[model samples]
Target: MIRFENVSVTYDGAAEATVQGVDFEVPEGELVLLVGPSGVGKSTVLGAVSGLVPHFTGGTLRGRVTVAGRDTRTHKPRELADVVGTVGQDPLSHFVTDTVEDELAYGMESLGLAPDVMRRRVEETLDLLGLADLRDRPISTLSGGQQQRVAIGSVLTPHPRVLVLDEPTSALDPAAAEEVLAVLQRLVHDLGTTVLMAEHRLERVVQYADQVALLPSPGAAPVLGTPADIMAVSPVYPPVVDLGRLAGWAPLPLTVRDARRRAGDLRERLGGQDGTPEVSVVTTAPPQPEAPPTSRLRLRRKARSAPTTAPPAEVHALAVRRERVQALRHVDLTVAPGETIALMGRNGAGKSTLLSALVGLVEPAAGSVRVGGAVPHRTAPPELVRRVGLVPQEPRDLLYADTVAAECAAADRDAGAAPGTCRALVTELLPGVTDDIHPRDLSEGQRLALALAVVLAARPPLLLLDEPTRGLDYAAKARLVAVLRGLAAQGHAIVLATHDVELAAELVHRVVLLADGEVIADGPTADVVVASPSFAPQVTKILAPQKWLTVAQVREALA
Candidate 1:
């Protein structure tokens, strides 16, 4: 359905091509996953299919590109709208209307579909994506995941033959991500629609792909094959693949079920292992005396031996209302010095709200939020820097300067740090990025690194990061883990609101699960994740009942 022949894309002033010799084909009714390291041109390749690379993005495209037999070289994006639907990473950029229902119908109206057909498709999409209840809601008021669904449904209403999606599930929760993937699966099976998606969260989509295309690096040829064949050698892969490799399983499994089927012996080998290690810090709240004996024993054993007079930060009965919605309700949390905590939940569960409250972006209606003994909302901006710092979900929101060097300089000035502190942090977090490049021109991961560097410059006592791994590849994510770990070890309390379960399993000491607007569960990482099937990492699912939550844990046990 889509074909790229000897395709190469060179931007306006770049010395080398962003993508070169990229040849791939997606058959009718199939889902092709485009994956590579950050800045390896996966997005460039996906854009070429819809005639956006050279036409809309101001780049030079060489060689033939066709979608549904229409040559992209001759057709612009608008001309191919009926045959192609492209949803970029930023959902807010895709919306042209204020309300959900209007956004859903806008594409159909533009396509000039019959009134009855348009109405039918609108209703069908609303029901398919569980957006019926939100039809009258303003697009800006919806959560990030809700906006993502609306963006997808807007395009699907037009009934395009090909769908090109970039990081479709990055903002979605586990259930919502599954729902979106299921919708894609149905489109491929029931409607014979072809999909080309570039996503960084491979663990959510790798098992659903019909074909895997690996772009090793920029200007290099793509390697295409079945999922297993590509995953065996691909640098970027899901945790299940890592577990399979660690266990020496032949023909690495793509899904948890397949790995679970072959994990009986490995489970036996790790039979007596106690994978849940003790936490390094104590909670500010007193333990419940009425708890069960086993639970109490476990908590006592896992609790730190050293006592702390006060945590670095604390949230007490927090309640936040945004517009008409209560984004958070009676939420209580504590961040101890030298601790790493992961805040996890479904979409619209108030994780972002909590982070905002901690960072003083949102004021609590009822309860208090204190960072380093001062209420965050009442603290002054200049003083807040030394108390707490946050790396927001949309990394670009924290960036305003034109160039990377300027942004770093601004960060240094704002934080009162050494002249080159931010730049040095950027070098440590994300190496090899040219200083002169515009922050807007950098890939999503690079932009995120810049934002993180800006936040870390202050060296705050408490750190809050929301979805920090959104666009990061495995290597970048590893570097991030190490950085965050080092910060925690240096008396900086870290809290990350993320949907990346693998990250939570591998990096965090504790997991805090939120639902609706309340804290539902909070415990050790292994205990919290292993209990929830939807939130468990792939390795944990495969090694169920063994209490092993990550490949590193399994590797340690095996050794």
Candidate 2:
């Protein structure tokens, strides 16, 4: 069990405590989900359980945090390694070994377990997390989802009584996320392990939480209750909860099956209605008039009333090979101007590769890739920016400046824009970001926002984003939806490679499903998602046989 008694954490040279008056306890064999907006102290609270807050992070702890009756204030992280295991947001940083089997055993070896015990636990963990086939695979070569599972399995091998996970499923696809959640469920029910997890994608894990802890804002006291109790009033929630609230369900349903059981009357009411949701008009202040526009900027046609049209970016017989791995195999795809497309697939299913090819990050071994009539691989960097812009999976890879302000300034200089142009975009996408804060010190979501702002400064005809909403909360996600939607309206083609099905349903007009380095399915959003149970949104599942994909759509139809 984990307990926090009047815990408050303040970093060095801070105005006030980042987390204050937080009191909660996770009973043995239970999973507690920590929910809050971006920049809230969710990660700070999770770090306290394993003594990473004041011990390694160089912060002052006001009260006590105990795990399995071991006071973290008195004990260091290594001292409590036997009973506590922690995994941070970035899985790559957690690995101390090259291969999966070695990584799983590293923690046990550090704990000084006998070789026999370590070997048995390694085998057991590989099987438990369904990583037996990939035990010898190198960690760097694994997909994002696979790396996540490996990171978790490395900690699970220690068999700790308390597990602390920060955004455990952020990088995983829907099915893989379900597998990870199912493993946690088994641990709670069968092994009596206590789990404390913080995640931004609430729709994927809210149903699995034994209890929900809501952290409304920074330095605010947390509210603890059942999932329905917290979601009824929580600002950050899934579409199903909103739909439940709209329909006045007595108790908010956490799962699709539960919502569907109570949706019969609502379904009949919306039987023969058809209407599009009234999208809010997102406005931005006028750009600084001093900036000069770059050349080769072609005016694009507006969005077509029909779906069939020649795409701005196209891939024909695309085959990519890297280090003996065939990432893409004879793949063909296209993205039309003024259209938003969702790229969905399992981890390592060529989603990132496709995005990379579009932006010229990866060279294809065979076939051709064209973005606005220019071959991305052969296009020069300066010229490519006018044609396409990419926000890669690792946001830090694109960031090198010391401070946020310097990064934005560099974006303006490189894009030939006005001095304050990049900063304005950052304000629209991510508000309240301090100009002096070091880019390394910001949270995962904040770093992603900064990187996105840098990419958007170029105003390329085609924009490609891979896992753009990894750590963004609902409010940040809504702002991103508005920004990206605005870009699409301006005749820019957008392609997002993500696992968040709700985002795909709410924003994109088309869905392209890939598997094993090939395009398996491509069609309209409703047609593709309604047929795939794992990728379907909660509202669509509840309103089945009615062809609705979001709560906004349902509300629009009813109105």
Q: Predict model 1's lDDT versus the native.
A: 0.84
Write one digit per residue (lDDT tens) for candidate 1, span 408-521: 887776665689988998998788787888888888788989999887876666788888988888889999999888877667788999988988988988999999899999
TM-score per model over all chains: 0.93, 0.92
Candidate 2 C-alpha lDDT tens digits along 74-187: 999998899988998889889999999999999988888999999999998888778898888889888778899999999999899989999999999988888889989999
Q: Which candidate comes out best when scored by TM-score?
A: 1
Q: Name every residue pair that clashes in candidate 2.
A: none
Model 2 residue 135 CA deviation (Å) reads 2.1
The runs of at least 3 residues in candidate 2 whose Cα sits more than 4 Å from the true structure, single-residue gaps closed, are 272-311
Compared with the true structure, all predictions reach lDDT values of 0.84, 0.84
**lDDT value for model 2:** 0.84
* Model 2: ten consecutive residues of lowest lDDT: 295-304
User: Worst 10-residue stretch by lDDT in candidate 1?
Assistant: 291-300
